[model samples]
Target: MSATPSWQAADGCVHTGPLLQSVNGFDVVACEACGFSHTLPLPTPQELEHIYSHEYYTQEKPLYIERYLEDKAWWDEVYAERYERLEAELPAGRRRLLDIGSGPGLFLAAGRERGWNVMGVEPSERASSYSREVLKLDVRSMFLNEETAPTLGQFDVVNLGEVLEHLPDPAGMLRLVHGLLAPGGMLVALVPNDFNPFQRVLNESMGVAPWWVAPPHHLNYFDTDTLPRLVQRCGFEVRHVETTFPIDLFLLMGHNYIGNDTLGRQAHAMRKTLEMNLRAGGETGRALKSRLHRAFAGLGLGREVLAFARKIDDSPSPA
Candidate 1:
């Protein structure tokens, strides 16, 4: 294999290896001028798959599944709010939606109720099986790539909520997804914003890796700066891109300050404290905090992002 040129990260400094995992003797260091993080020697697709498919990610802990199902009922109710905002301009005539990494089929379930033909591609047996059993979703146990690409027909909308960060080559994967879409189809993706304040506090002030910085599992960390470019490279023109992540910060702080051992007795205690913190914050305090967090996010301090786009007539035509 030939060595590739090191990426000059959004941060001005040049980095060469995986920023997330130190296992390959690859590490990330920051740029001085701007604060974008960069990793060394970008990972190959094979390395990325191994890390993602590692037991930690693919494992389906019953506790987590149960907790998410309980808490995510709200998301189920609120999901299409974004698409609804742009429904007038969203793909019309036909809508076949494909959700990559459709954990428990939340989006697909919601989309189905709203009249879109929906399917999901997930590698985890537990998650996909549960989606079929519980949501009655037509999800398949497949990973996105050349082999699976030809099987799924053209879709009207493809949504990848919080799924790109885990991939080895998001741009390449988007190419496959774009190919799966019919002309004028839309692609919506959500990615982590590395510049989120909580992450900044952990990395800059404390000099600790953001616990979210689990390497191998997450090979590509994106923010507003790199996202549009990545999507455009995959052959989609920007439609409407809005980046917001206050809720994610709340979750990240809970995980960091409260706890990480989700399987432990400590997690039980921490989760209670987290609930109390929200309750004490009060109904008004809660909304106020979310507003303030949004202000911070508007200033580009939030930890996650959502981008929406539509297929353009010209795609530089995929090979």
Candidate 2:
């Protein structure tokens, strides 16, 4: 196969740069300026469009939707936490929420139940239809960009759940999200925590390849430090950075589930079981899990990083 073309880094530097390694047919390189690793020769718009719309939930996982719905109880706990945080931080009376890249409208459903006026922009026909028809959510079946931002108008909160890493130009996408927000509006983004210390330990110490690094489908890699920096540069002030469960902990505990399909499925089921047990224990278990999540986030060991930021008001300060 032919080599892919190089692209400029977030710092605007254009050089061949240093190759970190290769994974799944893509060259992974470390950005000299920002110190974050990204996949080279970012996938084209058409390629990404087809992947997300047609193959993401089907070809990629095959059982993703089924698994997601099966784990709704555990996922709902996560959604509730997110809603509570946003509700507390955001100014009252500004409940307009726009969930960019909302898949199946789970979060939007959570927001609506919280009394927020919620809408979503999803690219997948299957997901969008499910969101609208099944959940009765107000979701536009399209991607969110400069041209589409105007029609959506301003929102008090804009969410990008598990969406940033898929983009070739994540910085550009954040700038668009900045435009979608009202003054003092919040931005919540969740991306895979690739290149983190825990992941490095998995690769270097445990003799496992970097299985977390997927390309084309996931073009950008961000960890705790780099994710917030990228958001700040895009005109949002960072508010909170937290993490979900570090499933890699299973590997550390002698369960090598990465490549083994049966083991991997068991690991997922174990996660759901643990969460369900904790949730059933009521407030005490919930509090303990919250603390554990915060601790994992502090160590930068979670599988995904959740960032909350607010759009900066650039209007001149009162003279």
The deviation in Å at residue 162 for candidate 2 is 0.8
- Runs of candidate 2 exceeding 4 Å displacement: 1-16, 33-35, 276-284, 315-319
lDDT by residue for model 2 (138-198), tens: 9999977768888988899999998988987677788888877889999999999887787
Give a tens-digit lDDT track for model 1, residues 1-319.
2132255544354554323434345454342222334455456666666544445334634464676676574455347554563365664567688898887788788777778789999766777888999888998976789888789888888888777877645666788887888888888888888646666666677665566565555555677666776787678887655554343344444444434454333444444355345435766755564465446645666556767788886667553
Model 1 RMSD vs true structure: 6.4
Give the per-residue Cα lDDT of candidate 1 at 206.
Answer: 63
What are the per-model C-alpha RMSD values against the true structure? 6.4, 3.7
Q: Measured by TM-score, how close is model 1 to the native structure?
A: 0.74
Best by lDDT: 2
Error of 2 at 215 (Å): 1.1
Q: List the residue pairs that clash in candidate 1.
A: 16-40, 16-41, 17-39, 17-40, 17-41, 20-215, 21-215, 193-303
Model 2: lDDT to the true structure:
0.82
Clashing pairs in 2: none
